[model samples]
Target: MASEYVLRIPLDRHVITTQRSLAAVLEDIRRVLHDSAPRSALQGHLVAAGHQVRLIIDRPEATDELVRCLPDAGAYCPATVLVQAAGDGACLAYDSVASAISPYQDEEALAVAELFDAEVLSLLRRVAEPAPGESGQ
Candidate 1:
């Protein structure tokens, strides 16, 4: 079954300074995924009003493996991600899930969500890192 993962990366100070814009960061992620997992169908676009980028990754194995490699790929900013699997329901922000209605089905779903969060955060940090000899301004 195909699992849909939505990555919502905000254009914060770190992102703005490193990536310059949401489009740039999204493009970087697209390139990374393309190079790392050629078979995974990756689709991404910017949500201008929110000043963030949303990346949709299809396929379960591809999503799991590709996301794991992202942290090592390059620098970027960390953001919330939503993972939705058919029949498995959806996993949202943990802190907000309590006050807001949740679709979380089980612990396994939460584990996957956490994994995505960590990997994505690492990926963003890598993306935000300064190049060669340039100072991270």
Candidate 2:
């Protein structure tokens, strides 16, 4: 699998999350997931952000570990992230909840964020060799 994506979101006890996306692709996806999936006690808000989804955390130290992994890009793709108080968490204000998010960004961080964003994006690559009985030149 190609490795070049990360899902970094911070969590806190109280977070106000609002978001807009660089591209329009996840709005529909968030609507469907939110409308159907059963809410978990641990989950806060999994809402839509233009074409992406907003993942807001409401826990302690949730962002500490995550911030260490990601670069401080202020408001960039993957998230228009915001870190509040020291104990406060982060806001991945764009989840691309519809299209899908690339999970692997680096060797240290694997495609683990797929679990958090709850979506998967396929790596672009061509498969060598032909399938059995398939045409070959």
Best by lDDT: 1
Q: How far is candidate 1 from the true structure (C-alpha RMSD, Å)?
A: 13.4
Clashes of each: 9, 5
Looking at model 1, how many pairs of residues clash?
9
Worst 10 residues of 1 by lDDT: 92-101
lDDT of 1 by residue, 1-137 (tens): 99988544333222213422333444455565664443333323323325233444333443454346443211221233332122222111112111111133334433544454445555555544545774422
Against the hidden reference, what TM-scores do the models get? 0.39, 0.24
lDDT string, candidate 2, 1-137, tens digits = 78885656543222332222212123322333343234331223444545444434321122232334543321222332222212221122233321122232442222323333333221000111223463322
List candidate 1 stretches off by more than 4 Å: 1-27, 36-53, 57-59, 62-105, 135-137
Ten residues in a row with the worst lDDT in model 2?
A: 120-129
lDDT of each: 0.37, 0.29
